[model samples]
Target: MTGSVPVHLEVDRGAVLDGDLVLPPEPRGVVAFAHGSGSSRHSPRNRAVARVLQEAGLGTLLFDLLTEDEERTDAVTAELRFDVPFLAGRLVAAVDRLGARPDTAGAPLGLFGASTGAAAALTAAAERPDAVRAVVSRGGRPDLAGQALGRVRPPVLLIVGGLDTEVLRLNEQAADALSAPCTLRVVPGAGHLFEEPGTLAEAATSARDFFLSTVPGPIGT
Candidate 1:
């Protein structure tokens, strides 16, 4: 239970996704990743962050949000990627699947979302307040969550690139609207993709720390 393993998550009869699951011995919590639009379980940036979470004794799941056919269609139409409600429903299904698994059922859950996925994560958190303990958004457009922003009860950490001015401003507005405990961290010299040196690492570390503090452990463990 301490290494990376591949998993198949069935979101519904129509969608079955591939994912990578990494767990430490008796993990304190589990984090599920929602990659940005056009990205998947193989995103190197998300994989890097998952490694950090795994090393910190938190189990991590990086999964694809769409099927191969859907990905191909989305590539052409760019429609499904921005459909926040659809993505949120998928995320909720993923969370339910995780909860039903014996290995992860006992652990509190956290969500780490990037770009459009962040909005999905926030919306999912609101939809399943009892299941999601915390959420972290990286270079995300949380304003896209709209009214769901007011219903997310779990603590949230919004990590943005300082140079990604528009997203930063949007995150600031989302922060003000969030009813839950929320913190906004801006990484200087980084852009929307956090392609700048050391910037992604900074965002990942903040996410790690946020989950560590906010995701509650078992009461008597």
Candidate 2:
């Protein structure tokens, strides 16, 4: 595909996830997005970043980490969203699924995570270091990843809003724990959501540049 295509991924134990996959021709790499908190594939911020990646000749997979029923339950209990291990497992499944697909097989893989999803992305990258080449987090809670942060082998780019001080500090601490090459970027005048006028664009551009430089380009390109 050229446009966003709907996909169903069977992650774990018959738990299927809905997603939208957008691929550019001869993409340099494929990025799997993990939305934070209770957010799903429809998150406008993640979708915006995905579009930027697609425009830059990278494929993007935006998927839900939880099932509909689980979402309903999480809405009330607020449990599943914070379970980093569970979310990371689902993300690893998605990564493996993408690796096995004909269109994305052999492509350099990356993860783009937001909020708590960032922690899950780091944990998943640690589990699949041989497969994941790069990682990028936007206003993420990488500290929540805990011990797994030290195991991530791929280069990491953690983007934080300048105004989101607590999260920025957490990312700083997470960076100190990472042995892999890691860069912490701050988008000035932006809050946790990057809702400011041009901050999200800056973060998106930084992500694009990082993936382009770190994730290996297409073979023979």
The most accurate candidate by lDDT is 2
Per-model clash counts, in order, read 0, 0
Estimate, for each residue in 1-221, the C-alpha lDDT of model 2 and write its tens digit. 49888999998878999999988778899999999997999999999998888889889999999999999999999999999999999999999999888888888899999999999999999999999999999999999999998899999999999999999998999999998899999999999999999999999999999999988687333
RMSD of every candidate to native, in Å, equals: 1.4, 1.2
Q: lDDT per model, in order?
A: 0.91, 0.93
The CA root-mean-square deviation of candidate 2, after full C-alpha superposition on the true structure, stands at 1.2
TM-score of every prediction relative to native? 0.96, 0.97
Error of 1 at 48 (Å): 0.9
Off by over 4 Å in 2: 219-221
Task: Give the Å error, residue 209, model 2.
Answer: 0.3
